[model samples]
Target: MLIFIILALIITILVIKKSKTKLQKTLNETVSNLNKTIREKDDIISELSKYQDIIDVQSKCDELLSNAQNEAELIKKRYETLLTFAQIEAEKIKEKSLSAKKQMDEQIKIRKVEYDNILSTALEQSKQIISDANIKAEEIAGDAYKALNNHKELEQKAKAMKNVIEGYGNKYIIPTHGILDELADDFGYAEAGIELKKSRQKSKFMVENGLAAKCDYVENNRKTTAINFVTDAFNGKVDTILSTVKSTNYGVLKQKITDSYILVNNLGEAFRNAVITPEYLQARLDELKWAVAAFELKEKEKEEQRLIKEQIREEERARRDYEKAIKEAAKEEEMLKKLMAKAQLQLQEANDQQKAEYESKLIDLQKKLQEAEEKNQRALSMAQQTKSGHVYIISNVGSFGEDVYKIGMTRRLDPLDRVKELGDASVPFTFDVHSMIFSDDAPKLETELHKIFNKNQVNKVNPKKEFFKVNIKDVKSQIEKMGIQSKWTMLAEAKEYRESLAIENEMKSSEEFAS
Candidate 1:
């Protein structure tokens, strides 16, 4: 019985030991599984946790990736905005640059235009100034040249004058002065052979050489010519009248207009004063003597007529008887009555014809007188104006006035000399020198004088003793009252006389006048 109990105990110990070992093994497996579970939990928790953790870790990763995608998209949007703004800024810069270039181009065009206008104006002004300067310079030079030439010409003339003065006179120049103007009148030159030359080219060598103006005197009339013609017609028949008169005597030369012998003294005076020189002086005297001899023969016939005048007592009775016999004839009485009536009618016709002729002649005379008066005016003006470096001698001469005397005379001496000479010549103290009546032809003055006065009437004037010397008396009156200093009163008086007799006055006085 003891042994059975030991075997059972052994079996129980063994089973217990095996069970302990298994339980320990299970505990280790549970611990390891728990560790694995915890790790898994951690892992599961971790695995499941891990799977959950993996799921959790995957969720966290997905969240992180989504956030990154959102950030990238934002970056892309910002880049696009930057690019658009940059493009806008660049476009604005380009436009501004183009505007600046356009402005610069416009300024260049304006500057060019202004420069061109300025250049053109400058050129035009320069050209005008040059042309004007050339014209001015040319004028100045021309004037200068003309002045130089004039100076040279003056010098040459002065030199020539000096040389001419050195020459001699007698053969080259005449000593006489009275013939100087006459020579000039004929030669168409002055005494010096030069027209404008005052100092004769010969005068420089020829001292006291000069000339007086030569004037002419003519009787104003038609009867003078007729009387001259009558003397020629009658030859020696009326030599008494011819001896006292001459073809050349001018102005009033007689004391009275009716004086028959007054012409004698006038003819003699004219002969003495006339320029008769040595050449013709002798011939003139001989001619005058022959005229005187013829006059003596004619005077004898008149003396015989005066002596036979007393023996006419019986002749007067006989003349009455003869006249009665003529009246008694029947045929003679009838013819006488018819003739007397015809003569009366003829006388009336003749008177009417004479009136018409006188009117026509008066008109012609007036026109001729006016023309002559104008020529005299010009001549008088020339006389008053004197040439330089020259002395003039003027005279109012001859019996053509009141006396056979010189009315006026002027010398280079003085006024007192002239007065003395006038007093000596029986000229009035108031008488002044008239003009130096200069003429190229002596006949022209003589002709003009005849146109003014009738030759027979001229011879009747007495210059010293007046009977009807109207012209001489008038001259004296003018000198006394008018206080005129000119000796050329003869010319002036004639002009005044003509003007006073205008057509208006003539028409008033006459019954018939030209319209």
Candidate 2:
């Protein structure tokens, strides 16, 4: 029985030991959980502190907003008061302006009435002054006419007496029937008495029957007046003719001369009794003819001078071209010779397969060298021949219109260069070449073409202008007649002009659509 009790005590001690271990573990777990709870509570406190700081900032913002609201309300009230005062002042100013405007309108009406009255009086005075002046002018004109008539009568009598003195002897006496017989019988008495009595009888006869003397005076007056009138008219006409010659074109001058001749002849014929003698009329016509001849000679001389200057300029240009061509040809020939030499050297060192290529290349270089030399020789020949050049027919349809062409000549190696220069900035579009004819006598060919189309020249007054208005067919026919063969381009391709017309039409269409 004591053994069983000792065993029970040992079992009890074991149970107590296990239970105490579990209790100690539970205490440790509780302490760990409490520490974790304290840490979570510290985190919550930190978050709450941050939220408190935000709340404080929000309160400060609220105070600032309230202050701003109060100030805005005060400003709004002050502006309303100012607006009310301004409205009251504006109403007063409008009332005063309306009253002032009414007063000004009344003053303007009174001033306008005074102005009209003054204008009416001035107009009446002006009309009276003009009428009186016209009456005085008529009286003066009538007096002048009377004075002129009296002067003409005196001049007629003087001219008649002068003519009578010139036709007969100044000292010759009139022959009376009985006076001569009486003088033969009583020489001394008859000479004195017969002279007195014959003078009285002559005066009496002139007073009674003066038809012959009156006719002579009238004829003399008519001739003198006609001569004076024609002289003045001729002088005036000559001055006018000279002015016209200077101002008018040469083409119109001949017509002007014909008109003036007819007018002057008609003036001469208008006079009565053959007063303008045929001899005098013919002499005046001869003077006019001489004057016109002199003017024509002067113009011809000027034209010749211009032509000579132009010819000199053309010759100089040709000479320059020739020199340039010779220099260029010499340069090309020298370059070709160097290339041939280099090719020959490469040919000598080439391999069999490469030798064939080099040989072909050498042959090409040799040919080029020969061509260059030939070109140089040709240039020299052309330079030596003064007439060697190219004659070209070209047209600028945009500037000069259709069927008009310029026939020109150039000594340049590339005749197209001259054509390009002719189609420069002076014209809106470039010229289209119709034909380029190379000739040894280019000037002669050009001259022949010009003569054939002389009447068709665009500017007949200036022959230096080479443009002609003729169809391509006519030109070709004339060229064939001159025994020249040429390729002709009958159609002109006015590319830019056509394009401009297209663009213009498109723009007009767009404008019309927009409108």
Candidate 3:
């Protein structure tokens, strides 16, 4: 029984030991679970703290939102109040404007009626004034017409008197109605020479015959002295008249001749016989006519000489120009040849880049050479062909006035040089070129232009004066009709002339202001 009891105790101890081990494991698991639960609780607490902070922030936001809402409400109310006041003020302004408009309308209606009355009265007054003015104008016009007629009659009488004075003491005598007319009818230097010789002989015969003068003195010496005195007086009068004869003074001299003849006849009458009888007077008149004709012939000869000299000078200038052109062309040709030779030499030994450059240079040089050759040929041809030249149309308004232009031709290589020479110090301003036309026959072109405008020549007495009073358009039309293409400067700049006028006007204005 004891052994059984011992085994039972040992079994009991083992059962107790097993229960203790199981308990220790259960305790360890429970402690681990507790620690885990504690950690979870701490995490929960941390989450709760975060949630608390969020809730606080949400609460703060709610509070701010509530405040904003309240402020917005307050602002809404304030704006509403202001809008009400604005509406009231606007209504008041609208009412005021309507009242003012009504008042303005009433005033405008009244003013319109008044204006209509004034306009009606003005229209009636204007019509009456116009009618009265028309009547006054008609009456004044009648007076003016009568006055004009009287003035015209007076002018005609004055003109008749002037004609009488200009007629050399004979109102019925025209310029070609006396001894001058007779001489012109059959006149020659040889015939005049013979007539002058006969005149001298007749004068000598009259003086010897005592027909030229008579004296009361019985003494031969006294009578001869008186006769000589009368003869000398008549001769002196003829000499005085003849001395005054000239191209410009022919008319005045003729009148002087008539007066001298009358005076001499009166002097002869004082000596008891007329010294200058009709026959003697005829002789003196013949001498005077011959003198006048000789003077005119000399003047004409001088003019012709001057024109010849001018032509010679022009020819000389043209020759010099031809020589110069030839020389210039030859020089230019030589220069181009030298350049072409240099370029060809360079091309012979040049690399690709340099060769291209030299070849291009040679091409240009060849073109230049061709141009130079052509120039040389042209210069030669021009030298050979004397007629080839430029015809220029130019104008100088400051010197010659408007509508006056010089149509001329020049054989110079540069035509403008001739034009420039013409516009030198001889004229107040430079000439404006209207057209410069190159022609194979420049002289023919110039002559044709001159012929077309011959009637419009400015200096009609001198054909050498190539100025014509013709419109520029007429010249251009004629040139076009000749089938010549030309550039025309229709409007003359007249720069210096216009500037001079402006300066003169400015000076006048300044003087006027100063005064």
Per-residue accuracy of model 1 over 171-268 as CA lDDT, tens digit each = 32222222232332333222222321332222222221211111122542542343333223322322333345333121111111112122222232
The candidate scoring highest on TM-score is: 3
Task: Report the C-alpha lDDT of model 2 over 1-515, residue by residue, as the tens digit.
Answer: 98989999999999999999999999999999999999999999987987997899899999999999999999999999999999999999999999999999999999999999999999999999988876776687877755565695456445445543564232332222222233333334324444445543543443344211111225767756665565456446545654654444433333343344344444565665223233333443333333334454456568878988976776677778778877887898788788878888998888888898988887887888788778778877887888889999999998999999999998777789889888889899999999999999998989988988899999865667899999988898888888899899899998988888899999999999999
- Model 2 spans with C-alpha error above 4 angstroms: 1-237, 249-285, 352-357, 460-464, 481-483
Q: On residues 363-462, what C-alpha lDDT tens digit does candidate 3 reach at each position?
A: 9988988887788788778878878899999999988889899999988877899999999997899999999999999989999999999999988556
Highest lDDT scorer: 3
Q: Using lDDT as the measure, what is the rank order of every candidate, best first?
A: 3, 2, 1
Clashes of 2: 0
In candidate 3, residue 229 scores what lDDT? 78
- Whole-model alpha-carbon lDDT for candidate 1: 0.42
For candidate 1, report its TM-score.
Answer: 0.15
Question: Runs in model 1 with CA error above 4 Å?
Answer: 1-103, 115-515
Kindly give the stretch of ten consecutive residues in candidate 1 with the minimal lDDT sum.
Answer: 249-258
